[model samples]
Target: MIGQTFNQNRPLSQSLDTQGLKTKTRSFWVPLSIFFVITALSITVLGPQTQSIFDTREHIVQLQQDNRVLVDKKNKLTSIDKSLLTRQARIAVSAIPVESSGLAALATVRNKAFSSNITINQLRVSEGESSEKDAAKEVRLQFEISGSLSDLLKFIDSLSKAAPLLRIASVKMVGDGVTISTDLEMKTFWAELPVSLPPLNTPLNQVNKKDQDLLGQMNNLKAESLGFVAPASASARENPFAPY
Candidate 1:
């Protein structure tokens, strides 16, 4: 009887052991399945979203750089425009008139000669032919003036400060003892009537160093008083429909 009871207890113990193993296995499988599902969701849903966020950030940075470059360019253009409106710029522009004639240049030379106490014996005017290189028409003045050497030198110096800039093409001088007779061939320039100004956005042409130096020299000279007359205003009847 004792032996049979021992055998019965052994079977019960074996059954309990089997049930404990099943419970442990079920707990392990449940946690493992949850971990796999979370990993899959992260790969499928979150991966592309992260990449898109990075791409958007890069685009924003590029746009910021472009905006900065545009701002700098705008500032530079504003500074240049301000410089264009200065007094020196206006004087430089006025040095070359839009339209002029030989008569005005001749008057300037005569005035300078009178100032220097020189006598102009003859005055001849001729028109220069225009070419592709020099689009503006040139006026050539051939004249003879009589004065002392000192007076002649003064007259030439004064010409440089006169308006409607003149170029001494040739000069011949003869002296007897004190008084000298000088023949001069000079040229001045003029644009045709109805001149149009360049557009504001136009780029400036390249200027040579020599030309820049000459302009600087001209700026140092005293301003000549050229009595300019304003053109008469058109009558309202002339263009009744035009804006005031």
Candidate 2:
């Protein structure tokens, strides 16, 4: 009887020990699993959100920098005198027109020759060649003229100060030194205005000293233009005899 009692107590004690171990394991594993799940959620969900916030902040900083630059440009632009700017703009346009200005160039030559007392014998106009691509288109003018050598020299010198920017390509003089017949090959330039504009965000650069001097030179050039008188409009009478 004693041995049986001892065996029964031993089995009960063993069962109790196993139950205690299982309870401890469940308590440790529950908290560990919860921690692992929370860690995975943070990596999968919160990580991208944090990165996006940082990227947006960097973009905002870039935008602010661009805004400051634009503001500075605006200030500079506003400080310029409007009338002086307008005059410079006109001078530049008159110097290099946006279209083929062969007629205007011819008029300038005719006026200058008349003023210099040089008689033009023959005049020819043709297209000119450009050395660089996308450069100004040139109009070549061939002129045959007769005048006193002093007058011819005066005319040639005056051409440099004329508008449309004439370049003397060649000159040949014949006859006595007092009265000279000359062949003049001259070139004038024009270019089509830009059709495309830069983006609004592009940085603007003010005209530099070199460009200002160039503009001043252009302003000194004289342009001759032909004038036309407007015709009077005729009124119609109810009867043809009303005119009499």
**Which one is best on TM-score?**
2
Q: Write one digit per residue (lDDT tens) for candidate 2, span 181-202.
A: 9999999999887788666667
lDDT, candidate 1, at 52: 89
Q: RMSD in Å for candidate 1, one decimal? A: 14.6
Candidate 2 at residue 153, lDDT?
93
User: Candidate 1's residue-wise lDDT over 1-244, tens digit each?
Assistant: 9999999899899999999999878978978899888888779878888888899999999877777766665566666646533654545444554565577677788878889999999999998877865466788899999999999999998887766667799999999969999999988777643457454334444345886676676565443455566989887587778877
TM-score of each: 0.52, 0.74
> With candidate 2 superimposed using the best TM-score fit, by how many Å does residue 227's alpha carbon deviate from the native?
4.4
- lDDT score of residue 226 within candidate 1: 52
Clash pairs detected, candidate 2: none
Candidate 2, superposed: residue stretches over 4 Å from native: 1-35, 129-134, 227-244
